[model samples]
Target: MKLKRLQKMSSFLHVVLKILSVSSVVIAIIVFFMKLFNSKNIIMNKLESDTIFYFQTEFFAIPDNQQYIQTEQWILVGVAIFTCILIAWLLWIASLIFKDLSTGFTPFSEIEINRLRKIAGLLLIYALAPQILYSVLHTILIPGYSFTFGLNMSFFFAIIFYCLTEIFRYGALLQKESDETL
Candidate 1:
């Protein structure tokens, strides 16, 4: 009965994750195009209103007067869209894992273990890639723009997932042994 409940919950979660993943993609695309076409007009209006819209960094602020700020802002938008897509991809992977669980596969099964590892790897990439790219591009493209790189919670989660993968591997081995002895 407990297993059935778990399976039902996993199925529900799987569906939810899949929906969220698709939605993220759609939203990212919409945002990207909006930024692409409307950014100049929006920035110009904000500037006229004296809204003091500037791209501020830890070290310095590039005000709207800078010729390259718009280009930099566009690049930032692209990065944000890329990150959103990456998140969507991660959600899709998680949905697949949940789908496996809903199909009555044990957590210790090979498929789950592999999927967990993939999630871990992707998490690590997700954690590091954006920061590295942001730091590099900003420092290089924008004068006097310096960004400090740091690890975030997703990195820790990646480590935890990797540990979980090993635990699941051990459990699978033990399960195999128990089944053989039965």
Candidate 2:
């Protein structure tokens, strides 16, 4: 029956979400440490190679003076690694939300509503955080460079999540009213 199928699907999703949450945490930790330790060496090696071979690095242009470029690249690598870990953490939190939803947690519940709103706000931050980090980096690291700012598609997703939270609030109100009439 449909109910049985729904139960099976929910259980499946619950299991998957739990796995994803754990894996995301592990992966984020691994990536954070790996990048933290190796990024400097990696950047150094690439810069050395690029200087010797007269080639440009893909991530950024190698300006004249290897020492100054090395310092700038180090900062960039650190910021990029931090950004990667942040995104993974966000995904882990998202998995937590989906996990509860799959395990019969009501969307209209206060706890679920709060989680949804928190994610919505995080999504907005997610949209903006990297730009702010990069802008600051550019201002500090790259002299005579103009600052540029823009929002990506994640802002749209944040808006959608916010709307979903409001819809859930309305649903909860309606459910409470119906319960009162019973």
Residue clash pairs of candidate 2: none
Which prediction has the highest lDDT against the true structure? 1
Cα lDDT of model 2 by residue, 1-182, tens digit: 86556656766765675566566567656655665678655542212221222222223334554556655565555555555556655565666666666666655777778777887888888766755675567556765342435546777788999999999989989988988999
lDDT of 2 at 58: 27
Off by over 4 Å in 2: 1-4, 36-65, 141-146
Candidate 1 per-residue lDDT, tens place, 1-182, comes to 99999999999999999999999899889877887788865331111122122232444445553777786676677667777888899899999989988999878888788888988998998877765676677777766565545556777898999998999999999999998999
Clashes of 1: 0
Give per-model TM-scores. 0.82, 0.69
Instruction: List all candidate RMSDs to the true structure.
Output: 6.3, 7.5
Error of 1 at 18 (Å): 0.3
